[model samples]
Target: MEQPYTLEPYQRCGLASLGLAALRAEYPGLSWHTLGGHFRSSQPFWAAIGANVPGGYEQRGVCSHVTSS
Candidate 1:
């Protein structure tokens, strides 16, 4: 059965990390740029998630995308 969002146990699990690792494996050189400015309250959340990305994250600039290894 489908579970409710609040009842889901993602908080104390490695769900996010696992998902990231899977994506990295599927797309070796995948990367992305931020869209404008982030909400003040969400800055911390964004920082925390991308802090350990394999390539690195740049939350600024005008370039849309650059694909390479």
Candidate 2:
């Protein structure tokens, strides 16, 4: 399948993960803390590398709903 946006493969994955985090925040039973922690622990290198990539650091998940609610 083709995506409407023009993001690269890794960028797509990162956006999808961020979207999942958004949905989880809207609904209960979604654990952003654990997920974020897991991602941090498992993909420390990826995060570091992403930071260096242009516009990579901005591709982060939003979980404000979890905290606001």
Candidate 3:
């Protein structure tokens, strides 16, 4: 399957990190959780980043366990 506006392979980590850091900076001491449904492909990314969040991915309505791949 083709991905739309897919991120470069090497840029994923740095980009995600920066984005999350910016969010944290904007909202200090806020608990971040993964809410709603995640795509089968994006699930891995969500799980990976969710770990660094204040709480491990609080898988609300998500079916799969959010864990680092």
Model number with the top TM-score: 3
Give the higher-lDDT candidate: 1 or 3: 3
Cα-based lDDT for every prediction: 0.57, 0.45, 0.61
Better of 2 and 3 by TM-score: 3
Query: Model 1, 1-69: lDDT tens per residue?
Result: 122122255653656556666877898887645445566855565566567875444466656454343
Provide the RMSD of all predictions against the true structure, rounded to 1 decimal.
7.8, 11.5, 8.6
**TM match of model 2 to true structure:** 0.26
Q: Record all residue pairs in model 3 with backbone atoms less than 3 Å apart, i.e. clashing.
A: none
Model 1, CA-based lDDT: 0.57
TM-score of each: 0.47, 0.26, 0.50
Please, what are the lDDT tens digits per residue for candidate 3 over residues 4-48?
233577656556666777878898887544444557877777677
Itemize residue pairs with steric clashes in candidate 1: none
The runs of at least 3 residues in candidate 3 whose Cα sits more than 4 Å from the true structure, single-residue gaps closed, are: 1-6, 9-11, 30-36, 61-69
Ranking according to TM-score, highest score first: 3, 1, 2
